[model samples]
Target: MNDKANNIKRQIAITRRDELGHPPLHLDNNSRLCLNCNRAINDEINIIEADPACLRLNVLTQSASQTCVICNAQEDIGRLTIHCRVNVFIEVNIYIPDNVRSCEHHLDENGMFHNRLLPGLRFINRPYLIKGPQLQLFLQHLRNVSANKVKGIDDKNLTEDEFKCIAPVSKQQFEELFTYCDPVYYNGKLRQIKRKDLLMFLCKMRQGLSDDFLKIIFDYHSRQTVSSVAACVRTSLLERFVPTNIGLQSITRENFIEQHVTEFANELYNPRPAEPKVIAVIDSTYAYVHKSKSFRVLRQSYCFHKNRHLLKPTLIVAPDGFILMICGPYFSDAGNNDANIIREEFERDANTLREWFQNQDIVLVDRGYRDAVPLLQHLGIDHRMPAFLQRGHRQLSTEDGNESRIITKNRWVVEARNGHLKSVFKFLGQTMNLQHAQNLSGFYRIAGAILNRYHPLINMQDVNAEFARQMLQRSTVPNAIQARVEVDNLRLRNGQWRRLYGEDVPDFPLLDLGYLKDLTMGIYQINLAPSYIQDKLIRENDKELQLDEHINEPGFLRIRLFSRFRNVVKHQIFIAYTANEMENIDNNADNNPISGYYCTCQSGARSLGTCAHVASVLWYLGFARHQPNIKYPDTSLLDTTLDAAYRQPADIAQNINVDVIDIN
Candidate 1:
């Protein structure tokens, strides 16, 4: 077998050399004018080879004079003029003269013009002859180029960062993925295109670069060839790679449960303590596409909610952020909401999803899948969704709010999974061409499969397990502080308000990062904390408004914050804390000092997680004040960069004036 492989390799090499039209080795000792130095060309002289094909094809070339060929500069620019090699001979079977010269700017970082035809190169008519060392140099250049072209994006050339940035995978992960492509067959030949083509395809997906750009990057001859290679790789991966990593058939239902099921999901959504159910979070993400020429397609892809032309793909992810399945990049038309799309999946029974779903299995979804709740029930699949407000209701009840928080806490992983897909495979983040509409589904599915197969789980830490337990413990707890504030009519009636600053609230509970995370139940609210506090400080400094304090009850503090919305409403936040009267008590401790908290906002009264308003105050008193020189992002520049448009008095009066004129 080894002897046969050697013979095959030898034959392939000989065939390539023959196809290159390389002349057989012959002795030629004739001295000629060198293209590089304008001197005699011999075995001892190093003559530069210019693109001679430019002369035959009438393409652009620089003068044979001493000045830089590209710029035609008369005066010396203090830059070295390089004598480029005969890439033209490799290109169009034409020999470049030795007298041509070009500046360093035209050359790439490798000091060679990478396969591209340089504009300033001087081409000559005569056939360039070389002997001994010159001929050996030419052959060596050809060999090096061939080797580099074959090597492509292998581990030897690129660092770990470069590999990950280009292919979004480590060298180790790339090697494993290459195993599937190494045995790839094309036209009845095994390993026909090699793993280099696989790297090209992955680089395209990760960078979202143009075919032309990718051709230049990967050293391909044409954009058409690049497209062909990508197509071949896509087909190969879809057949052999995607099926093993993603979709319902990738792993058994039991195996998926055992591997990807999270403690948080189990504790939050599992109704039966005896039986462990498959907890999956379902969500839909959109990929924006350019407007199509066909009106029907334009209408089909237009999404009214987003006010954009896009396609929607439904992502089903496990609680541990493992992508279970990706379904339909269906039209973003009015008819295809998350509910409709999911219903279609069940109706069509795509990938045996119906069979995969067990009776007691739980699916955590947002309000977008509310309409599909009845269908989930009919299919014997348990689904949990956030609570929806009635038409007249201003806020969710404490019970409803807490339940919604629990559902959302588990459902957030699907969103993270979607974000991961977009971040790693940047192709999905941008507005894709309408020409690729047919391949959009394949692109997302392939990306999903790659992420599932190679990437680490989003929430795999032991700390998450502890956080989950805390969330479960607080799931049924009601907001007692919220009830007390409502009963006492604290919001309705005005009290003698005192201005509250960080220094004034010394008795307030001090919070650390971990405690803040526990209070919010997620980093999202904590992230918004600094910005909210900054806004409050700016408002206080401007004398427009301040955080007004109303403290009638001991160890209970009340402060009102302006709503983040455009409305002129403010939410009254109440925090019940133990006063730090003892001098020996640890002020910076991460213990539960702020015993109870509540706000009157829509989802604020939840015991499971505090609202952003309450979180902001707590973050300021406990965290932000403790840290010195906490510089928030300068958002004031946004106001200075552009002015908000104000309606002209004439424009506003135009409609009324027209009405008056018609009446007259």
Candidate 2:
């Protein structure tokens, strides 16, 4: 009889324009004992009913309806009824997702409410204009609807089918599942999605590249924000994925020995080598740091080591054909010597280090690491750095010298690893700073984690194959040993080339030197070593004496011209060299007959220059003359620029040095 009476029209009350200034809270059912924030309003309960709770009824005949009431709400006598009853009240716990957080609502026992903003409107309805992420807004709306407990609408209650949204789950259930996580307090960041939804998505993908796929869920975000967030997450999640001591502490020596070492060794030997088997190699690379702002004031002096331009980090690595160790990057203040870095890395004690050695652990370090030999022995590490006679190391025996060359020839692995590490993170070379220190350390740890995901350059099969090949070559043809003998014989026939020219070379071909040219150039940036490395061996009872120090040992060792060609044969330097590296040709001498070929120094292999030694060796074999074809540079031929009259411009020469220089 009263089905039409089921159509409940909420009472609307319109106040006069003069009475529109009161707070809407005064129109509530009972302001004297109201705790609206913590109290829920539900209409049409089984015992009672609720509607028009969230909405304040306002009836207007001729004037605009306003929401205002007197202190005595029941006595106001407005043209509307402010109904507050329970229609669908149900006591239940909430189950909020981890990503969804709840706000704290406060209402005093005396029915008064106050907060930084409004009591119940915990967060501002900012209405994120964000495109793809309307999910947050959807959740917010559900909360608003649930707080008021409005009656449900079925298919017949709505006019349009498409407008019919699904029924919202109970809000209490969601809240029970997740504790509110205040993102502001957590960090100055916001959660873009509900925790439950995010976890669900992650679980669904179940792959290593979950972050890449996260873009789809947040496509509505601004492109710039999205990209930045993605990048930050990439770096951040790297820590999450890989347990490192800096972040989650996940690295140890066991992993290095079992996983990384085996992986690297395999790769080195699996592939065929061009010549003799490369057992091990050693090299050093420099890591740089930021400038010191206080240096000028505190130090009151500018030293290259501590100067603001750059700091130094030197690394000793095993870079042979196989698995290499990131041995020691002796980190220090700027303006430190390379040799000193080596001493630090080896712990300054010879006998103490011998315990860390594995079988066949040949160290291919630079001559700067000479002091580390005694320490290397302690660990059973074979130290095979090249002989820099001028720097006062004992002269190499014919056999020892050749062995050094062989080790160096295969020592390019350090350079490659150094290149990969520094290049991937250029900021490591920028001026060191407080925050940067943390970042750099994190960078190294996170990078290792990323590397683990991908396959290493080495593998077990590869190691086995390479090991087999090396064994075959050593038994069958002995490439390095034989080459060394031949080179020594050549030098013997030619006599010593060191003192033959005995001239300080000021102007060598800058273009001819390749790799070393660049390294030297960089060292020159901080004034490391810029000039030619001169050398001559003096023999006393078959022992050798250097200008700086003499090591008289019982062996067939003699100090002759430390020929520039020495390095090129097996110690192929990848850069240009100064005249000191060659025959030291005099600028005004008329006695010496100059060679007409490229420099025999390793520098020639790196750049376009030829020192006196290279020139002499090539001339003896007649390779300096121009030869047609084979343009990569003939260690055997020389193409003269004699056809042109003008010399290289000063700017070009200056520019060349800069191009090659890199600071340690």
Candidate No. with top lDDT: 1
Backbone clashes in model 2:
95
Candidate 2 lDDT over 298-371, as tens digits, reads 23222354444333433333332222233333344342456565556456433533334454455567765666
Q: After TM-score superposition, what is the CA distance of residue 127 in candidate 2 from its true location, in Å? A: 20
True lDDT of residue 217, candidate 2: 40
lDDT, each prediction? 0.70, 0.32
Quote the lDDT for 172 in model 1: 87
Stretches of candidate 2 exceeding 4 Å from the true structure: 1-284, 296-308, 314-362, 390-398, 429-438, 455-664
> What are the per-model C-alpha RMSD values against the true structure?
15.2, 19.7
lDDT per residue for candidate 1 within 1-664, as digits (tens), equals 1255344333433443454466643323342223542332221122223433322222223534576655666554223222245465665554444455555544533344533344334443322345568667777878876777663446558888888888978888878887776334444433233456778888888988999988777777688878777776777778878899998889898898788886656766786644678989999999999998999999999999999999999999998888988999899998999999999999898458888997878898889888899999998998888899978999998888888888877688888888988899888898999767789878988898888878888864434556667777787787888888788887776664565655666676556667677678777787776566655555444322245566565566677677767547877887888765443335356656888988888988888888888888887776666555455545545444655664122221221111111100
